[model samples]
Target: MLLRLPTSVSEARECLAEGAVPIGGATLLWAEWQRDGFPALAMSLRGVPQANALGPGTLGAAVVLHRIDDRVPDVLRLAAAGVGTGAVRRTATVGGNLVGSTLRCLLPAALALEARAAVLGPDGVQETDLAEVTAKRPLLLDLRWRDPVASAYIKLPADPGGRPPVTVAVALHADTPGHRRLRVAVRDGYEVVEGAAPCDDNIENALRTLRGTALGDLPETAWDAVDAQVGAVLRAAGDG
Candidate 1:
């Protein structure tokens, strides 16, 4: 197998003209490689400085999972901290985590961040919502989001060692009400409710629903914890 390690984005772009696969943490790709055998050509982003760029809005694809905890939004850090063990955090890349876990803790945070993603491939680059990138997809280059007043991520069942069954990400801009800006992923899928982060009204509304309601369906074991978590974040932001 031949691997091309490019130190710059332009160089990396220049390579894989014939469609060599790109590898960041190799967390997901490594599994496929083991199952289907190695590809003829692979591009490694480990040497690419541009692949680890981090700023208020831009983050490179090769940034490791652990590093993001301190660098990213508060909620994003919570999600990052929940992903596996220390060694996994050290080796896993943000780009990998973005596409690896189905019931990912990061998805809600990314949504709350309103993150946009750039895909780098033989087609040059294309930008889209971070939530649009599926686990089956590849070639992510970077993620960017505008700064908000407050953002947070939290999970249910209180397990930091494994993926949670439900996760919520909340974002409140200075101009926006903190109680209303929330997006939640029930499993691998989620929706941004039309209004509010969920409170009395939401719970009451759920009681009126016929079936399949989020509030109605919330597991008894996790509801109180979820409520408290959301409350704490809002209170920290002085919204409560």
Candidate 2:
């Protein structure tokens, strides 16, 4: 199998039409290729429509991360930073993250924020809820957001090994007073354990896990212990 590394959107479209698999950052996909030897044409979308444009807070195709960084909530930017490391962040597309099913942290934050997905398929451009696309369809392109809102992504470590978290959660909150809403999602790797839009139940459940007996062994309570550590970091960042 061959790999087509395109530097622009037109080339990406051409490769897709040629039945090639779109690859962003080539981090997660390459890892899988090395481990499993899954042979498929690999296509790279680096520097095509621009790097930061596919972030979770934009409504249009032009709504990249660089453009919406000032407006999106702080937690989301933190999740983006956590997407692999510095090198991956520079090359990975938000579109690729959602498609790769890498983890729930970043996508859930976008979902909590009421983000949408913008896809340019064989049929042309189409739009739908970003979370829905991730949950259901084989997404093609970028992720987007509808209304003005606040979003947060959380990851909780398991045990004292200091490993990457086992459970990841995200929340999106509406800005309006009477119309306020929250969405929370909990996942391990690419598998979703729980998700609630207008997240009263999940948040209550999360807080409960910390306060009460562990429920269903989902790490809801363990996260509370981790929250303190995460909070200190946030506080330090704020102080800085």
Candidate 3:
């Protein structure tokens, strides 16, 4: 089948309606086509709407990963960088990362930041919590999130020679005088964790407790390492 390029979201959805599969970055789709054979009509998002509008952090689905790594907040940059090396990142896109196989980092990081996605489909645009997009993708159009006071992303290395499977991202909001709220997401399939402690200086305990529950299934030694690492991240967030 021929590769089709749509200059706008509406045109892309029309391609989908005509049985074309959308391909952002073409990284994931290309890998699949190489592993299996491509008998499907593919739609490339190269010219889609808002391709690189990072000024407001409005990441278009087609915006390449290298740009995301260089432009977004560190938390998300770390997540994007963790996906692949420099060249691969340049070929991957925001929408592709959101739906990448065995993705254990970016989704959680976006969740921690309270990001939202606008999906465009034959049914039109639907606004959704970015975290929810992981559950069900609808041809991601763009992603947006509020700037947090501070945010951090860390991936615990997988067991020797294995790919990292457990990653965590945390963001803090100091919207109130004495109460500081922390939002976090781990790649453990658990719901986004939210907790509040009294003031920015007091969030260490809250973070420790939340991580403890989420990492409870690990062996004691592993849990200890995770706890210590998370504690450091929380401290850095507070100080930032």
Candidate 4:
């Protein structure tokens, strides 16, 4: 096994170009190694300044989950704080969570917030929608988004001792004098509902579609919980 710790973004890219797998925190990779063994070459992004940078509306890819404090929006903060456990939070990076094969809480939250990602790829760094970055599984450099009027997140576990199968995030933004824009992102889908207020029927229908198409066949009880949380978030945002 070989490890290369790059101190700058360019250095990191060089290492990556040599076929070294990028590593930050290594929380997910650790699990993979435990099951499937290690990669031949790995580059640590923790030492890269650009990957560790964090500011209002901008989160460097290497920023650990625990570092996502009050500096970010409540929805994002809550979602980060809720990932895995305290130890996992300390070791999981924003980039890892966003690009992980499995659904992580942060993805839905980021999508709901309309966050964009700065990706470092073969062509160089480009800013694109977070969804696109997730699908393409590129090297995420940072994430940026505009401040939202309000946001919320919820996750329901598949079982008492299992990962959550249903995760939802909602962001509310002021659009017109008497209306608001609602962005709802589920574990595997996203929907936008614009009106004077969030319509229950429309949101429910969207969730149903998501459950059927992307999220698999979730039980009605799970949908009920999602409905309850969505309502609570809307109320907190002064819409309900």
Candidate 5:
């Protein structure tokens, strides 16, 4: 097998034109190709090119989360830096984590950070808001975020109860010096709800419906835990 290591997306594209499946970090994709040591033609992103800031007010795609966590004073950075332990955090690209969906814990925070997904697909390089990107069907390249915002993610580990555990992500911003802003994602079931973060009224309505109609659908223990965790995380984020 020939392995082509590229430093930039363009270089990777050129290698792809030569028939190579791109592997970023290969943290997750490597398992699928482990027996054969990757496909016959594979390009490994051994080292990324010099990462430059993109968009208005200094945002960047290539900046690793470690740098971001140290620089940004928000809960989302804390959540990003804490995802999947140290080894996974070191190897998993923010881009990969974003595309991996709500399971890995970045999607909720991305929604909170006000991050954006930058794509270089068949249609060419384009950027979309992170919240929008998470809900769409597309190939994702990288995630971008603005400076200085607060965000947080909360989830319950899988249990033997046969129910998908609870997961929530909350983010807040200061539009003016003191005007507060918020966004939240609640993945209660197969559907993910995106709207104003900390929608207490909506939560009340949902809870009413959940109690009135969806009670038997979910185990009482699981539902109670999910509700509590979501409330705790939201409270913490609001204080943050």
Candidate 6:
């Protein structure tokens, strides 16, 4: 396998244009390699200064999950911490989670946070909504979002070292004093519901539609937990 280390965004773009697969932490790529063999060309984003940067309102695409903690928003931190084992978390990245095939904890968190992404493509770099970038699966540079007034995340029951079947993330942004806008994002749905807080019926309906399965498949206890968690987050955000 040939690896290209780019020190700047321009170099990274050039490598990408040459058909080098962009790699961040490369945890997911490693899995793909195990099944499908290694690609001929790959570009490591780690060497790029911009891709490693993290700040109050921005998260570099190459930033590892373990690096996301108290410094970031609550919902994001919670989601990142739940991703995988300590070692995996240390190697998995924000960009990989956003575009990987499997469901990742950070996806919902980012959606609820209303994050925007900077992407580098054949044309050039452009700033666009995170949702758009995810859908298009472009080469990501970083993510940016305004700090929320409050945020929360929750996941349903799962084995000690296993991922949950469902997860939810909520963020409250203050539009004006005493008026907070609520945003909720679900794991499988990849859709964000904004404006008013969702009721139990709304939650149930969303789950049913998003999972593409009958609600009866989930136990009553699971529904209760989801309801409770959503309410708790809303209350914590002072929206309930």
Candidate of highest lDDT:
6
lDDT of 5 by residue, 11-104 (tens): 7567767777755456667776876566788765445442324333333334444455545435456556656667777766555555543454
Deviation in Å, model 4, residue 176 alpha carbon: 5.9
Stretches of candidate 5 off by over 4 Å are 35-37, 50-68, 100-102, 131-141, 160-165, 176-179, 188-191, 197-240
Q: Tell me which of candidates 2 and 5 scores higher on lDDT.
A: 5
User: For every model in order, what is the number of clashing pairs?
Assistant: 4, 5, 0, 0, 1, 0
- Clash pairs, candidate 2, are 52-65, 53-64, 116-144, 182-199, 209-221
Q: Lowest summed-lDDT stretch of 10 residues in model 4?
A: 188-197
TM-score: which is higher, 4 or 6?
6
The TM-score between candidate 2 and the true structure equals 0.64
| C-alpha local distance difference test of each model | 0.64, 0.52, 0.68, 0.73, 0.55, 0.74
Q: Report the lDDT tens digits of candidate 4 across residue range 155-224.
A: 6656765544567677766655655566666663232221123433365654455455433444465557
Error of 2 at 189 (Å): 5.5
* lDDT per residue (tens digit) for residues 1-240 in model 2: 687866655666687788887665565677878888866686655545642353335522222233335445555666666655566666565666676644644665564455666665566557776656666645355555554344445665455434446544344344555443444444554455433333223434444443342223555454553354333433333411
Model 6: ten consecutive residues of lowest lDDT: 192-201
Which of the two, 3 or 4, has more lDDT?
A: 4
Clashing pairs in 6: none
How much is 55 displaced in model 6, in angstroms?
2.0
Judging by lDDT, tell me the better candidate of 5 and 6: 6
TM-score of each: 0.76, 0.64, 0.81, 0.79, 0.65, 0.81
Which of the two, 1 or 5, has more TM-score?
Answer: 1
Question: Tens digit of lDDT per residue, candidate 6, span 1-240?
Answer: 899999999899899988998877888788779799988999989988778878788888889999987878888999999887899999999888887745656877887788888988888889998768767899888888999877888876666645455776777677667555556666633332332342333444444443343333445554464456556766775546
**Best of the two (2, 3) by lDDT:** 3
